[model samples]
Target chain A: MARIDLDHIRHSYLRNPVKDSDFALKEVHQSFDDGAAYALLGPSGCGKTSLLNIISGLLQPSRGRLLFDGEDVTALSPEQRNIAQVFQFPVIYDTMTVYDNSAFPLRNRGFSEVDVDRRVRETLEMIDLGDRANRKARGLTADQKQKISLGRGLVRSDVNAILFDEPLTVIDPHMKWVLRSQLKQLHKRFGYTMVYVTHDQTEALTFADTVVVMYEGEIVQIGTPSELFERPSHTFVGYFIGSPGMNLLPVELDGASARLGSRVIALPGAMKSAGAAKTELGIRPEYVRLGREGLPVAIRAVEDIGRHKIVRATLEGRELAAIVPEHGEIPAEPRVTFDPKGINIYADSWRQELVA
Target chain B: MERTRNNKARFLVLPVLLLVAFSAIIPLMTVVNYSVQDTFGNNVFFWAGLDWFDELLHSPRFWQALARNLVFSGIILAIEVPLGILIALNMPKAGWGVPACLVLMALPLLIPWNVVGMIWQVFGRVDIGLLGKTLSLLGIDYNYVQDPVDARITIIVMDVWHWTSLVVLLCYAGLVSIPDAYYRAAKIDGASRWSVFRYIQLPKMHRVLLIAVLLRFMDSFMIYTEPFVVTGGGPGNETTFLSIDLVKMAVGQFDLGPAAAMSLVYFLIVMLLSWVFYTVMTNYGRES
Candidate 1:
């Protein structure tokens, strides 16, 4: 196992990248702990794949260095670094059987046939493809092929880390959950350091202990699932993580209160000085209580989402969403109150601390 | 629930049926008709009932031509397929040099076959040809017209130069269609260069390689114009292939019945060999 450390890594597809926008991956300084499972979460074109490629040594960084267990292996190839990568689309040798496909990596590294057979059989069983081991990989369905791809990565006992670039993109919805749980189980059993990259938050939240949320070629936050839900470090994380994500209202802060239009709400702590920057109060919809006396809101639409209802309304002429109980009564005119403990203040898109 | 069958879609195939009839079946039927009958003079015909076929099968000349055709096709395929694959693998994957290399490789295939023969013929003349004069200056006794071995070498070289490009082009098309992920995964798997070629490149190129082999085999087996233009099947029948001998029998000697019988036998051999090649290759694809 290896602890991958990215030391100010930056990359650009262009030959001459003068501006920050020219870089596909901005300067990223992060460390993946040994044997820890992490997910690089982002939207399309946000450089998560680039960072994964860099970590796997498929593409060398245009700037800075990468270290594995403090070795400074920036110039080494993927083979030399001993990395196993599962691509977005399943890649299998069409001429080989499923058994041979799993054994290929071990054989390439000059393992004995008996050892290769034992390891391959165990890996096939782990991926639940033991019964189809003799079948040709070319005739297998997509999910089965992806399982073989995963099996190939797991067959080798000496891999430093296994990098996955949206490996579940082609899997069926039901199989995705099954394979994800299987991967979690594998990680728990083997303690292999795995870095999974994906755009789906549920996949990231479920599969990763720490999710690295990225936006516009830079990481926005690196935190646990509950941390991301409770306190998103950047505006993009607030907008990206939850299902009707956290709502932010532009507000004026004075002492221990925030004012929006004619309504004033109490803050948990006092603001120092409302500097000449964009200020907003962020709160999750789950924390918003629909009651009789607070800031008045015009209810636009109410959606029944099985467990709870998402109430879309206009507060101070800005769109806001509140989660209410499914059996909660709705007055003709609803007034919403923010839970003081859940209020987070932001200045210029960065989360700020309030002084008590 | 069972759905009703649509019988009206059968008429949509009428055009294709008529086109195949005019293009393939009619010509093939004419050959069959000529193979089974004998003609003396002025449209007077007699049913030979395999008499010409028996005569041609017993003739040693027919067997010799058939052997020569097989040897030539075998040699061409043996030389072209591996050389073409090597050249395609070494080709630049991307850059300004890609189009340049592709255009250069395609130059030989663009030339007319007989014109290529004429060019080689002139180039090999002792008096005025650069190659012949240069070889003479090097003290090598290389005369294609008088020597049987030299004539065979010259024809084989000409065939290689004229047709290796087709194999290269087909293999190159197959090579480029493979996605980059395969290479990346191969690298991560620590695969050797030979392993990558054996597992990834060769399997992907199998379909195109089959096409290349089939085209080369059929064309070289019935080859006529190039060797005809260069050597004219001369030097005591040293370079006389099946097509050249067929012309000699039908046109020079006016032996139509034996020539038609020989032609049918040649077509059958080609069809049988091609079917064998196709079945072996596709079965390999499936069983793997």
Candidate 2:
């Protein structure tokens, strides 16, 4: 419904942030396209919630301009900006029935009784709480209360954006899945500009069309799920995305070959040192090939995880993990090789494009 | 967990039972014994049966004191509860002002009961005190010692000044415990100031407010020290309460049987009122 633009936004809880480290959110300049589902993904204390709050206008940035649909709304409140946010915990008016709870936002915006009633009923049905329209919100379970929360946001279809701040945290696992799928369906049906903030990789990967990965107080990468898996822009992204995460190994680069310990391995592509002080090779565990060839590794353990086996090994004193298909043979002497497509080179922890 | 069925473990409570007998049971039993008998000088006693209770129940003086107690408690609750809630709502929620406001609200409650009575008694003197002299100069004839209305007003104001802080402190605690998300969500939902208070803040403060109401009710009903010191149940017993009347009956008149009977009735009244109130409030909360 609205394209949100963050122009060099920076925030700090302190009155006077003397240094950059004092800021909770470092300078960030990005624009989210209208009608696109984006997830702000990061670990705890990584400033994801701060960024979400900024978007919702619940928090004003210490510095920068926020534009909604090209209109500067930096000084506007959440109500003025017409933003709806679902918090980590379900918030409901304990005295109001589910129908009235969902109708609150609509009624606040001066909608007529006929319109409010129609929209509330439609949203309640969408959230699978249609039968509970007459029940007071106090005695509802966590998930049902969360659905009522979702219904309030959904009732008003013309809002600028709907934001979610770990809204499924109190829900059970099975309920989380149901609510997430319902949210996806709503997003697709309405084309709402949704920004979900979470530390969960699976949720971000599946729910978002574009995932914005953040670390410390800055965004590390913004890309699609496939793009992030194949081409990570920062070492943090590589370490944060996958199940076992990408294995990083220190290497010394020379011409087109990198030396690990006393052995030299041919690089898949050319390297540009550019006076770099540190270099490492990054690769996902799914692409790590273990066979009877290439560099020898000391296999420490093999864990059978149903569909596949995870080979835990030590290669040149560096720990590594490789996934093998079910029933795959583990050679008497195991050797590991990197898939050329999975190879990523980092210069000072920033991923560099390997020239083919 | 495995259940431990040790019969000998029950004997560990012997010390507590002995302590209770010394602290609560023995004194209550003595009062009961006095209530059922006629006592003379030098401990000469005779069986009175239910005669003391029947006489006290029929007396208009005893019924008037009970009515006065109920009226005082009702006025105190009506004034203090709303005033405390309003002050708490207006108080600053953060920064240096929080501690300052809390300490200021707590000052009235920290004074000794008799000291509060003494302070107000002197402070309301028509010739020498600031309030009384100022009221006299303003052409208002406010003589607490001579006028019953003025005397009752002084007692009620004194009680309000002393005890409203307990309510404010409890409600403030309740207000702070509410998570920040609820406010943020309310704002996003475009709730007006009145709606936010009615829906969010009031519901959150429900339990603490119940405690505040019950405590203020009981404390105001059993009030004795301050009013007793200020009015001495004077101005024709205008400020006399149940506790004050019972004290006068036992200590001033030395009528042990009638005083003990009155004490038993007063205890039952307080218990019955508190229980009924708690049950009604809790049941109302549970229904929705």
Best-matching candidate per DockQ: 2
Cα lDDT, model 2, residue B69: 90
Write candidate 1's Cα lDDT for B1-288 as tens digits.
Answer: 999998999999999999999999998887788888889769888899899899988988988988989999999999989988999998899999899999999999999989999998998878888988899889999888988888888889899998888999999999999989899999888899999999999999999999999999999998999999989997889999999999999899987777888888988999999999889988877776
Write model 1 residue lDDT over A69-91, tens digit each, in one string: 99999999898998889999999
Looking at model 2 chain B, which ten-residue stretch has the lowest summed lDDT? B279-288
TM-score on 0 to 1 scale for chain A of candidate 2? 0.98
Cα miss at A203, model 1 (Å)? 0.6
TM-score of chain B of each: 0.93, 0.97
- Model 2, A52: alpha-carbon shift in Å? 0.8
DockQ of each: 0.74, 0.80
TM-score of each model, paired residue for residue: 0.94, 0.98
Where model 1 places Cα greater than 4 Å from the true spot, the runs are: A261-265, B1-15
- B134-175: candidate 2 lDDT, tens digit per residue: 999999999999999999999999999999999999999999
Off by over 4 Å in 2: B1-5
What local distance difference test score does each model get? Answer: 0.91, 0.91
Q: Output DockQ, candidate 1.
A: 0.74
